[model samples]
Target: MHATTGVGGGLSDEQRIESAAHGLLRDLGRLTRALLRAGEFGLTRSEVSVLDALAAAPLRVTELAAHAGMVQPRVTALLQKLEDRELVTRRRCTTDRRAVETSLTPAGRLLLDQGRQRMATALLSALHTTPIDDCERVVCAAQKSVATLAEAMEPEAT
Candidate 1:
């Protein structure tokens, strides 16, 4: 019996890992979309990304655009929508009067909290449904994998 031969036929370790990674990514995407659809205060993926970035701190339009990986004009349009909802506010940068800075309002923070809570609830439900031992092992392995990737990807210190 070759290492790659099984009921499903030959699959190298790399092939198995790649298949698992793709499945995980697809499931995550599905979960996110489902959660957004089920939630009362729904937000588009781009909106959520922008809000997550702004959660760190207020930033100028250019900085926010970079953080959200969006073009300035698109970000500006999104900001306008957020402003209309009173979820964010924009003001002239004191130090750089020519630049406009945007920040999450209390409402925005509340929405972010709600979104996080929904994610936590979904994750907890999954954990509860799975066997405890299996969950623990999988989670531990995932954490180690993430850490390994982060370390490998980290830039060299000056």
Candidate 2:
């Protein structure tokens, strides 16, 4: 009757934690690959990321780069492509003519709306493969774990 033994009688706490983490990563990787292949909005991974970021608010090019964790030049290139597709628009910064801010166009919002539905459908289908109670429990625990990790990583109060 070891503390680590489960109903199956052979797993340690360390082993269970490791197994859960590995499974989560594998599931997420598979989910991401499927989403990319579905081409819900005809956007590349980088483009989807940029759009998602901009959905939060309009941002200058530099701010976008920071939020996207990309170099400014790469972000600029992505923005150019998004603009070409009419999914995003850039305007001269009122206070700084040398800089520009970018935001989603109406068309972009439409695209995001459709893309989100497709994504939700795919995610729901995947989750439905698991038991309902298990799915809810796992998702809740994962969200809490993520929040805890974020808090732990934040700079400590002075």
**Which candidate number has the best TM-score?**
2
Scored by lDDT, model 1 comes in at: 0.78
lDDT of each: 0.78, 0.80
Model 2: runs farther than 4 Å from truth? Answer: 1-27, 129-144, 147-158
Q: Where is the poorest 10-residue window by lDDT in model 2?
A: 149-158
lDDT of 2 by residue, 1-158 (tens): 22577543578777776676777767766767787665477878889889988897888988888767789999999999999999999999989899899999999988887887786567567798888778778767866886676567553410
Q: Which ten residues in a row have the lowest lDDT in candidate 1?
A: 149-158
TM-score of 1: 0.68
TM-score of each: 0.68, 0.69
lDDT of 2 at 22: 74
Native-to-model Cα distance after best TM-score fit, residue 117 in candidate 2, in Å: 1.2
